[model samples]
Target chain A: MTRRIRVLIAKVGMDGHDRGAKVIARALRDAGMEVIYSGLFQSPESTARMAVQEDVDLVGVSILSGAHMTLLPPIRQELDRLGGGEILLVAGGTIPPDDAAALKAQGVAEVFTPGHSLEAIVRWIEAQVAAARGQAAW
Target chain B: MQPDREPRPGTAAARPADPGAEVEAARRAYEEALARYREALAQSPEREGLFTTLSGLPVEPLYTPSQPDPDYLAKLGFPGEYPFTRGIHATMYRGRLWTIRQFAGFGTASETNARFKYLLEQGQTGLSVAFDMPTLLGYDSDHPRSLGEVGREGVAIDSLEDMETLFEGIPLDQVSTSMTINGPAAILWAMYLVTAEKQGVSLARLRGTIQNDILKEYMAQKEWIFPPEPSVKLVVDTIEFGSQHVPQWNPISISGYHIREAGSTAVQELAFTLANGFHYVEACLQRGLAIDQFAPRLSFFFNSHLDFFEEIAKFRAARRIWARAMRERYGAQDPRSWRLRFHTQTAGCSLTAQQPEVNLIRTAYQALAAVLGGTQSLHTNALDEVYCLPTEHAATLAVRTQQVLAYEIGVVNSADPLGGSYLVEALTDQLEAEAEKYFRQIEALGGVIAGIESGFFQKEIAEAAYRYQREVEAGRRIVVGVNAFRQEEDRPPEIFRIRPEVEADQIARLRRLRARRDQGAVTGALAQLRQAARGGANLMPYLMEAARCYATVGEIADTLREVYGEYQERAVI
Candidate 1:
């Protein structure tokens, strides 16, 4: 049997505001992806470790704290250190467009800011999966 | 029909000279329509209370002599009187403004302590401690499960050493501290108390609060480490201990903030929070504590959401309902017990990452609503919260938001500025009625614990949350940068980042602590904690001993997990 696209939906750092994060997690689960939620305040190392251990296709870091500048890079770095460069890295939160570009440069595949609907996020993930499978890239 | 005519400014634009005349004409027309409706209703048997408002309160199309009784004084009592729907204090903010509490913590105790001092210097009147997740869960910085978690959520605290460092130069007796911890509240409180004692401050002199609300934990936060029964038992122990020892400290802050943030409506927040408060009151009563003893120290924490009018009405209804229940139902004589004081945090859920700067505007509006609604203390979330832990600069702005409201706005000059406004009062009355209905339903459900067990509260909250989400998704509701007024070209400027080395450093610290601490004492403490967990002994004292001996949170959690097992929630919504 083909393995499901395991996704780790984790809230990084001290941000306890999880309503959006929960909504996204549920949407992903409903989409039939196996999601392992690393509950709030996960460090980048733990996030990377969990992504590797769970053998997830993607690691999605959700942060609402302004600390994303200081927070997201470490996860990207850790993923590289763990030699999981092929595993897609994604982030969502209050990140600005410019910061999103910077994050993409740091190994993040995409940045989902506020106003990006669940459909958009799910579609993006689907596209990423297809691209990885040598289909048309989004 | 007629050619358009533009009137001169001096002469009424188009015969607009009759100001009072126009008013009279409009009034007469409305009265005639009202009389016609009344006559029609009189002839129709089914049209009994057509003039009544939707909230079931009697109203009239017009307030005339024939409109029936208008006993204003009877319904709208003076501020600070029975059924305090208007305001709690006589002077309210006129005499003394609400405390500008900055909720902040990051990295290590020393780092947070510096931030605390900085905030205090910048005019923060009170300290609201936001502990790291491991600390919040009662795990030490060095625990295995605590890896990559230290100082990330808030400040990492291990044993009395961390607590002492957290409040090193800060005088506990002088500055009131509100620690936002729940599951491990008793242990944390013990640590706080022991720290205060070491600071030469007597327990009786210490004044502050612990967000030791575990019922809400099960309903919303999911930070709970124990089952409902053991958690409530621990909370009761804190209440008992506080009532006897820390006379000035509030043992539990019945929190509706998290519930509202969790997607509950205003009525659900009001009803469920009051239900949880009553549960605590009942537990204290069961422990043989006087209704007034623990009740007076009981405080509330609420969320000031974006719906300005609804948020204000919720606050007004909350005070009235709490006051009435404490006086009439609980049979409390103390005025202190009758007062329902609360701390309000501007809705973090309301802030959007999409026009991140717009969050400052959202926060300002929510902060204004909280002040108008009469909060005792307030924490304004930073605009950058949706990104990472708020930068010091961002947190300063958050505090400044409160200061601007307190001083610059002159809004604190009077009490309940919206008290007599028709819309505000009507909304407050409506909220009160709706909340009362839920209270009755909860009563039928055998109160809070039963409601919680049956998943009734969670179902209600989840449904409301989902419904609200649907509204936002469907554009029925407007979130400035989210569902509407969206700018595709905009992007955030900067985001906070955490270094991987921080986690590596934290792991190293844990390893060193383990190597340095007495292996025998650590083993002995874990054994005693496990034994205490198995038995009916109050876990606070035992946890305190464990904390003192450097037993990490994971060790304590492991011990309790052995006894209680992990909680696997059954989805209800």
Candidate 2:
């Protein structure tokens, strides 16, 4: 069988809102992805380091406390700095479309906000992993 | 400022009517009614949908006067009496309407101060302060950890000056303020007390509550600066100190707001919150404090969710449970200690980002339930909350929703009007029983702290959250604007924006204060605070001294951080 799609979910900064992060993490695990949740209060540097160390194929960060404008770039930069540039990064939270668009432009593969289903997120992650893995045969 | 104990209304409603005689007569009548109902159901079979509450608890098609309560009067009791099931006050809202406390804060202290003034002018009965994540986490605006987070979410108060500005012209004695800060609650609370002192207001005259319930922070909010043992000790210190000096102030508000927001069912919210509150009571008792003294000031905060009747039932159950436990178990003599007064905030998780206008209706109904459920104070969520903090327009509408509910809706005309309703009574009984089951389970886990240590609460909340997500995904839960009624164009609502300059302005202000304040005084006060923290002495007085000397939140927190190491939480999912 193909290697299980590995993903890491992170909640960075002083934001303690983890309901979304935990839900998404479990959804991925149920979707047959090997998932690592970065728990609460992860720094950008530490989150990126975890993704690289875990050798995950995708990293999803939830920034509900509205610090995406300040925290997202560093998380992206640190992932690239730590030789995890290949790891596709996605974000989620109560982020508005304007900031979501800016974050997407800054290399976030996708942005999921409230009202987005866990299935939609799982599907997005699955498609990305399959495409990145050359659409490997089942 | 204490509520008068006279004039109870719901209490005089009716006695339970002898259960033995009534149950037999009602049973025969109920049987006939049930048979007829089944015959009608067989012909037209009701609607093709699940008959369940928002929390997924099964609801019967009809409720009848069955066996009812074995000892109903003792179990529910009268309003403002033991087991205050109907309501805490005799007249409830008829005596005094629930405080319309809008939880508002964003941008710089000055900007938030303006919003506060505007809200007070708009007939908001109380003030609630929402601090930014940095302030909530005990970091200064200039701290590296506070970058991008300074005043972005809520007001940032790095020093006494920020707090002084935040409450500039507002007299501390006149207005009741509730601060939503847990991890650094002691520091923020001290800042508030010092602000009152600067205004020359006696601490005894202070009427406010600090969300200093740290156990809930560890279990649900995940915003702890210190480990559980010391964090709770700090909370007890505040309670003991508050009871002695700030007698009118509630030092801690045992909260299930975040617990419900984190996806637990209403029953879990009630049980876990009461368990946490009981733990605090036990902790204070261990510290040699009288239960009557501190428990009277002990308050609660609950979330009013989408299920109107269910949320109402939860609140009713909460009151009944707390009253019984406080009087029977904890031996609190003061009726004030037994009364469970809570401030309810409508569920933010229930609001949708899609078709944001729909959230107003949802919030209005939730507010109505809170009023019917006998909330002492309420904070209605704004329509734009799903995206960000409420804009001025959104915030005004939120307050108006409460105003409408209070003034126009006529919900306050009767206290616990649903008290005798068969369905509500059944739900209250069912919820109270369910909460008792959870209480036993939590006790088996060695109480709240041990439950947190074992990740029991985290796991339970996570499972519920994931299940809720799946329910929405499967279309089992038809959330308007999300699953069922999606308008093709789901435009974003007007969002309140904290200026990009807020962080910079706050930092500059902090630097300016640091340059002018007595650096030696700051050092001396923080040292004394550390010594008190090292010993068993209450840290509140020393903290007040530090706040008096203008010691920054970060400095005082870091000083204690030296002695009580920071807590690192592991991922449970």
**Maximum-lDDT candidate:** 2
Question: What are the per-residue Cα lDDT tens digits for candidate 2 across A1-138?
Answer: 689999999999999999988988888898888989888888999999999999999999999898998888888899999998888999999898998899888988898988888877788888888888784343
What does the lDDT read for residue A52 in candidate 1? Answer: 84
Q: What are the RMSD figures for all models against the true structure?
A: 13.0, 9.6
Per-residue alpha-carbon lDDT of candidate 1 for residues B43-116, written as tens digits (9 for 90 to 100)? 43332223343465654322222332222322333456556676676656754679988788877777788889
Q: Model 2: residues >4 Å from true position, as ranges?
A: A135-138, B1-70
lDDT of 2 by residue, B65-120 (tens): 34544244445544565678878865566557899999989988899999999999
CA lDDT of each candidate? Answer: 0.77, 0.86
Q: What are the chain B TM-scores of all models?
A: 0.84, 0.88
